[model samples]
Target: MASITSSGLGSGLNVNDIISQLMEIESQPLTKLQDKAKEAQAKISAIGTLQGALSTFQGRVLSLSSASAYKSLKGSLADTTIGTVSTAVNAQAGSYSLAVTQLAQAHKLKSQSFSSVNAPVGTGSMTIQFGTYDDKGTSGNAADDTFEVNGDKGALTIEIDSTNNTLTGLRDAINAKKAGVTATIVNDGSGYRLLLSSSDSGKANSLKITTDDADGNDTDTAGLSRFSYDPLGTKNLTQTQAAQNAEFQLDGIAISKSSNTVTDVLQGVTLTLQKVSARDTNNAPVATSLNISRDTSGVKTAVEDFVKSYNEFVKSVEGLSFYNKDDNSAGLLNGDYVIRSMQSSIRSTLNQGLGSGSYYQSLGAVGVSFDDKGNMTLDSTKLQKALDTRPEDVASLFAVNGVTSDARVSYVSSTAATQVGSFGVSISSPATRGNFSGLAVANGPITIAEGDNDMLMVAVDGASSGQIKLSPGSYATPAALAAEIQSKINGDSRLKDANAAVTVSYNATSGKFEMSSNKYGAKSNVQITATGSATEATLGFKVAQGGTGSDVVGTINGEPAKGDGQVLTGSGKAEGLKLTITGDTAGEYGTIGFSRGFASKLDQTVTSMLSDNGLLRSRIDGLNRDLKNIGAQGNTVTRRLEDIEKRYRAQFTALDVQIATMNSTSTYLSQQLSMLNNLASGNKK
Candidate 1:
């Protein structure tokens, strides 16, 4: 009999193909396992979605809790703030107090001087002299000379170096010592000549005619003892400042000034004085800080926002806890551990701990309720009752005790850092401040008031020349002298070298040199300082160099300005520059400008808020992409499972055919073998 080896398969596929088929079948189970895992992950993610909604609900319910506390206290739940205060109507005539803080002015006059009558000699003890230079004491060339007005013997001299020729020796020799007023040369069309004028302005703005060069009176040839005079001369005696300091007190704060107003002493505060009127009355305006504002709508908006958020959270929890009556009676969060955890978390939002204050302490006291569906409902009457009960306690709940984050919330808000401040430090906003101008005067180079570490230095450096120099003993008026000096400067080449020009500027309002201009841009800059004392006499000199004309403004200091007739604006004192700050710094109500300098950080912070978009949106988009991938994979798996089922069915059908044929063949063979055995048995018999 032929032996059937293990390789006896009726001509079908080999074991390798069957093994590959088996591997494909095994792969379907793994794919199904992976898909199931993805679904489980998606469900887990959906469960925690209520956390944000719960947080929002807590915030809103908190307001109701806050309002109840407010009502219980004496304060109203509707407290609010009004800013950039617009409606501050000016007080009528009988409505304010008027007081003159401080003022000093060079009252102008149209008057003449003492009509002169003096020969070359007289008998008064004092002698009046001229030809004073810009630097030295005196000189005696027709160009550099001296004359005297005698108050003693009434003697006068005109030594065009004629007296002992020692006069010429006097001026020529001392030109370089550089002691006092000396001759300065300027060449107009009429050859180079010298003029006598004070190096300063105002009353100290003068030429004190005397008979000396250094410390000598008629002793040597440099003295007026060897002088002469012009027969016809008169000078204008203008009203000018004797001292530069303007001082008084504001609410007794001891304000020292060099101009008409003080600025930025307090944030956004400016004080202007309109020269104390002779009949000061309550009708004239002054100010104090007792006034309060009335509108309170911001408080309402804040409470409403809180409530809306709280209600949304309550609704979320309710949805998760219940089942839908339709469609498989399914709850999306059914069997979710995260959903229960979030529901418990939301309950804690409105339950802030109470303090010892008298008003509403808990959200339960207000009309806030969560239904079986977890939707929050507002009970206005119950809310009102809580307000009537514990108002202070409610106020304490929402009155910004600690930060939520920095301004509002955070992880350890209960132990957050306390904000200590000397100035308004809004890191989220620009730190706003204004520049000061006019004259902030002090006592000396500095003053040493007893017991005080600080001193007062109130000399004004930014003053318009209040008076013209008048001393040659020959000019008809100070205006004439001013005209001559102005003419000489306008005609001189060296004036450009000196970077100085004397131009007459006029203001119809104040009638003075209250305006000036320079080479368009930065050439207009100048440094001004005062060198006199303040006391019971005439104010000292008001001198300005780079600025000229009655076009000069009544600035607080040399910082420059534009007076709105009431408030001064632009170019103030601080950081040591004559700045032209562009804004209404002295508006009655405070206004803020978005400056790039002061608010740079705020800009970056706002930019920072915008910056959060890229990162957060990226993360959200990544989640969306991940979700899409999961969904796409789930779809793929579902379709693949269907295809696999069909293919597996086809495979099983073919396998059944093969097995059926084998079984039939086996039966046929067995029958043939039995028939053969029977035939053999018969034949053998």
Candidate 2:
């Protein structure tokens, strides 16, 4: 008989079921490892939730850290019909009486009527220049005016050939050049006419068009010369409107600006003139009251938002680390050390004072404090009182600020590396501007004749100017000559492009003219590179170099500091602290008090906690590493369990085969014994 190979077939025993039961018992350790991995994954998710909460809180904290948040100002006008008023952060709180006498108007001119818009005009080169028209008598009468070209608004020359000789074609060609003048065509009752308007609105921005007409006569009212309008010579184009300034009165003081939008007259306020002020029965200008006040709404909203966010963040932390003692239930991050430490650090930073001698040194001084439950609480009444009394001090309590004792020493900025303390400021050398002093003139009332002493070339702050032409006239005084030279030098296109300018002054006692660069620092310098033939004889100006400017040299906190132009930066513990030195004296100016407020400090703290190398990140990384190890160990245990199951199946199969063999042998022996007994009985019978 063949031996039984199938399990449990030989001995009639269930070997497969027994092996399955044994393998189930062997997988206990692997199940425990899998459970632990799931726990770690839950903890990682919980940490991510906490990090999100911190990031949200950090965003709110940043809203109160900047200085601009506290510098907001509100402006209002009594007469809204006149204009609108806007205020900047630097605007001072005050009331001003304003009256707008005139609104600025751009210069507009129209050509003589033409039969058709497509009518052909003679080809020629037209030159356009912008300048001021000095009216010797009547304002609008061109016969009594003399025009002086503005070098800053450089002249633009346009060519008119057969391709662009028609009126419409000329408009297109001029528009393509963007020459600070807009050209348009309008149909009058008689015929079509071309209109030209100045881009700027001011007396100094009037237009002067001169032409080199191909029709032989450059000034006649024919061909391209018909467009020419030189107040001193030709007058073909009709002046529809005059370039006028915006005249206004502030607190009974006269003020005039080129544009309707005036900003420079006031420190940080912009007044947009709409229409002329209303006149009273006496024909006098009516006054409108402009009131500028502190805008506390933004600051108040920011404080409320910060408080709410902080309290919510505290609640989130408590919920994430919550534990139920009665039922022994715990959260995923119940015993997390990183979360506890981060919460403690943020709270500690908020409780610390800003600095010594500081107004509202801590957040509590501004009515913001942490409650017993770790939630931030704000007293609205106290906060309102603080804002009403010392709004700037309240701002300092929540933002990084610097205060200086001396008016000459102004705080510019500071960094996180700068410590909170009082630092002394001492200057070794004060900054100076570059200047050039010309030789004394032989006599007064100098004559600047054409083709003689009309041209001048100069370099300011390392930037060169083109040949500047002086108007041919007789200067009665040295001051008049200086003014003319300054205007021409500053108007040079090349110097203007390089943002370089010069201020010329006449030293009456020295009987000489002085020119100085408008820039500061070592790069500031002035030099007269070239001059006309009779320039030295008339104005005492020749090729000469001036003194170069120097940077401010200073020490901060008794240690060496860096100086660039007018800014002085500190070193050592006061590193990154910057101050603007405006005084000329070279001694100790004063001390600067620096402080980092609650929001600024807390913002940094929360940023660190959420960084890659922060405590939360480290803990998460460790947990991930543990999970990987657990997976590897689980894989090893799984392979061991498979081997154990294989062994158990082999042992059970062998035992079943042995039991089947024994039963087979017992059957064969019983048959043999029965046969022997029957044979013995037959022989006895």
| Residue-level lDDT tens digits of model 1 in 1-685 | 2222222142343634664576577567557756655655555454445445543543444443322223221111111211011121111111112234445332121111112211122121222222212322255334443222211111122222333223233333224323223433334444433233222222212233333232244333233332322222222222222323234343445555534444433322234444542323755323222122222233334455656665665566556556766765645557555455444433443343333322334545566555675555666676555444433333444542211112211111111122111111111111121111223232222222222311111111222222222222233322233233233222222333444343322232332222122222223322223222331011121333233112123232233444322222333321111212222232212211111110111122223222435322333455566666766776776677667666755565556566657777898999999999999999998
CA lDDT scores, all candidates in order = 0.34, 0.84
Q: What is the TM-score of each candidate against the true structure?
A: 0.31, 0.87
Clashes of 1: 91
Please give the clash total of every predicted structure, in order: 91, 0
Which residue ranges in model 1 land beyond 4 Å of their true spot? 1-32, 44-48, 51-296, 317-322, 325-327, 364-366, 379-393, 399-685
Clashing pairs in 2: none
Q: After superposition, how far is residue 619 of candidate 1 from its true place, in Å?
A: 18
